[model samples]
Target chain A: MKRLLLLLAFAGVVALMAWGFNQAIFVAPTEATMGDVQRIFYYHVPNAMLSFLFFAISFVASILFLAWKNSAPERAQAADAWALASAEVGVVFCSVVLITGPLWARPVWGIWWTWDARLTTTLILWLIYVSYLLLRRFAEGAQMQTLAAVLSIFGALDVPIVYMANRWWRTQHPAPVFGGGPDSGIKDPTMLAAFGWNVLAWAAWGLMLLAFRVHVERRQQRIRHHQTVAALAGK
Target chain B: MSGMNDNSGSQNSSSKNSSSKKSSLKNSRSLRIVVAVVVVLGTIGYLAYTGQASAKSYYVTIPEMQKMGAKAYSSNLRVEGFVKPETIQQDGPNVRFVLSEYESHNPKAQQNPRQITVDYRGSEPPPDTFKNDAQALAIGTWGQDGVFHATQLQAKCASKYAPAQGAATSGAKVATNEAPVVAHGNRTN
Candidate 1:
């Protein structure tokens, strides 16, 4: 019955996500100036925003783990699991942002990528997370946790600088889409409402997925510890 | 004191042994394979996405557009510079014109100043300000005879007006210095 309830909840969320996505896709008209290509903004912008949120989570969890070593091992273990979960989700969103961003750029900028501030910073953030995951896998117990946390916090620091530099650097890509930047392309009430709802829906979905992943991880860790203890007793 | 020291030493040794066993279990072939696959796929996907996005903007200057010959003219491209006076032609829904850099104040220069003629079949070009001496980006195909046939025209708005000049003084005034570029012919539509 518990499993069934969880399944039903997951399905309900998926349906909501689909409905919200359709609202963003169809309700919004092609921009008067940019034409059909502007539709990429609906998914691309939200994913970028959410990716940063996940990266932030990874940084915070890493800090908590490093500072409170004397606390029960469970707390640090939980934080590590959550941090990895967030990192995996973040990497996926970063991938999407990297993809759709170029699609929108091709027709307008005449190139697939630029050394623009936002693009470079996002790419760097992606690389830092990649290294964080690697460090976790290779290092030993306390060392792994400590190194991953330090790397993560430093990486999160880069996000704000990336945003600021994107503004400060002169690039062909327009200003913020959803925000009231130069490209306030969205004036329609239906479109704005749809964008807002979809961002919220996706963010919630991502958090739920992270939670589920962390739960599984913690259970697996407990099983391993129990097995180790049992095997020692047998010996 | 020796008993306590021995117990501490044994505890440390046991913890080290256990951690090494856990580390050995983690370094399995399957784990390595999973990591490799994820990294390889992610990099390839990133490259492909970036390639697709950078394909659209104008890639050449006016002179470069002129040199590429007939095939270059047919491909959709962006060409920049000032719209040349007296060379613009309108026939039915199509418009043909040459864009050239103004030869400065000097009249006697070599090589007829590189220009592109556009065969534009799009909307009526923006007002008189969209004519000679105005900076514009013309999107369309170039013609065999050096015309850039623009399907779309984007003109840079005049930027010299000081805020102090105010709209009341210059807003209502119409430009009457030269004959409008469209005087020669009209669009059939």
Candidate 2:
């Protein structure tokens, strides 16, 4: 039954991705101004939004790991696994956002980069999460997980700041397409649909990636437990 | 009996020596961590400081740029306004244009808007989005000749590009006339 469910979910995600690709490239009208180059918006924005979401998930999981560490170590390990998985996926998504953004900006904004509040805050956010991942990889002490948890929390704090940067400051970055005041949002229904389909597709793909990572992490944790027990028995 | 006592004494001292060495190693490790954190934070702070100081706002209004007077000429400045329709002239990589205070695309906006001329001599060509009524930001220095001598030019569609009502007929023009501008992609003020 579980195998069937997993297979179904995998199929569903693939379908969603196919539909989204069609919507973004084929169905959606060529943008008025930048033409096809504007289509980068479909991929770039959804990735950015998902990256923030995954980071938030990591933050919550990190807090759970820290809180339950002493009383329920097994639960804490599970939470830590989740935290690690989410952080890894978030970084991947963030990398996509950073890369895709430059591609769009070069033709539209005429510059590949700027030091506006929005861009700067986003870059900083990526750096903090990257450092968190590095700490998890290299730091071997017993307190490494705890340290990474604390760092994850700090990194999550930047997420909100990044979202708010353009709103609070006039940036080289464009204002939010939705809810950015009077003139914001997609005017054409087709454009909006294309954006919607891509958002669903990318998010589903990201969630599946996160789940796979968590499963791998949990298996590794269990193996580590077994190794330690066997080593102690040998001693 | 003396030999046995000496052996025990040596063993005890050696254990003590090892423990102290371990403690010192741990201390240095933590000290290194603290130093690393401080250095990373300090570097980010310094970079953020310099980056923001160079371009404090996305783009300053033309009046604000004019008010800066001597400061505008001495330091880097980013001035934003609507490109007056038909004022854009390109010569190789260089372009000359006029910017107006109000949204040029908006029919309801002020007709005789405050205007400034821009002389953009950047190595790179202006983006394809640069066109009539587009919102353009020019970055460089104000010359003594009263022209904004731009080292760079960034352009996007005005906010009026929204295809609110009647996107089928009018929306084509609305969406096509002005290209999609970036959100949060901005300037060196």
Name the top TM-score candidate: 2
lDDT of 1 by residue, B1-189 (tens): 577556655787877577557667866755985686577567645644553355333335686666777767569876666566666676755566667754222252134776666667775544333554445567777666555666666553221111111111221122122221121111110
What would the per-residue lDDT of candidate 1 be over residues A116-178, giving only the tens digit for each residue?
556777889889888887887787566777777768877787776555543454333454554
Q: How many steric clashes between backbone atoms does each model show?
A: 15, 12
Stretches off by above 4 angstroms in model 2 are B1-56, B107-111, B157-189
Q: What is the C-alpha lDDT of each candidate?
A: 0.63, 0.80
- Among all windows of ten consecutive residues in candidate 2 chain A, which has the lowest summed lDDT? A26-35
Candidate 1 overall lDDT versus native: 0.63
Q: Give me the chain B TM-score of candidate 1.
A: 0.49
Task: State in Å the error of residue B114, model 1.
Answer: 20
In order, the TM-score of chain B in each prediction is: 0.49, 0.56
Global Cα RMSD, each model: 13.3, 8.5
For model 2, residues A1-235, the per-residue Cα lDDT tens digits are 9999999999999999999987776666555456667778889889999999999999999999988988899999999999999999999999999999889899888999988888989999999999999999998544999999989987997887798777766788888887887655676677788889999999999999999999999999989889899999995
